[model samples]
Target: MNREEINKLFGVTDEQLDHMAAEYESGKWEGGVGPIVPGRPRIYDEELETISFRLPKSRVNAIDARAKRNGETRSQFLRQAVDDALLANA
Candidate 1:
């Protein structure tokens, strides 16, 4: 993908990528570019994927209320709920 597509898909800024490049070029490069990894690092050694589904209006409103009470966005609240559920099953 092009840089613009990459930025949209990976949530990385062009300036950030440029800074990384400058750092790399400043290195010794003794091995001559052995390996390269793009994009930002994942949190908690975990990769997250986005999923979409429809929910009832009432359920959405309830989730929003609880998320607000917990000081989290709807996505964060849902992610934590799923994580908790997975742990419980495990």
Candidate 2:
């Protein structure tokens, strides 16, 4: 996306994006070159696929609360739960 589009989409200033772009071009930023990955390195050992589905606001709040209580982000909590459930069933 162009600078304006990106700025609009992410609410970043054009100046900040330009600075980041310069840093990335200089190879000073490790994260801007490749496909973006979600989750922290400690939590995710492999590439991740992005997925989305809508849930009720209450359900989202419940999930977020559970994840927070477990010291996990929503995505990490969901991923771990799904993996565990699938393995258990298998």
Per-model C-alpha RMSD: 12.1, 11.2
User: Tens digits of per-residue lDDT for model 1 on 1-90?
Assistant: 887997989888999777777877776333475544556545557666779999999999999999999999998899899999999999
Q: Which stretches of candidate 1 lie over 4 Å from their true place?
A: 1-44
The prediction achieving the highest TM-score against the true structure is 1
Q: In candidate 2, where is summed lDDT lowest over 10 consecutive residues?
A: 35-44
- Give the clash count for model 2: 0
Model 2: which residue pairs collide? Answer: none
Give the TM-score of each candidate: 0.51, 0.49
In Å, residue 69's CA in model 1 sits off its true spot by 0.3
State candidate 2's TM-score. 0.49
Worst 10 residues of 1 by lDDT: 28-37
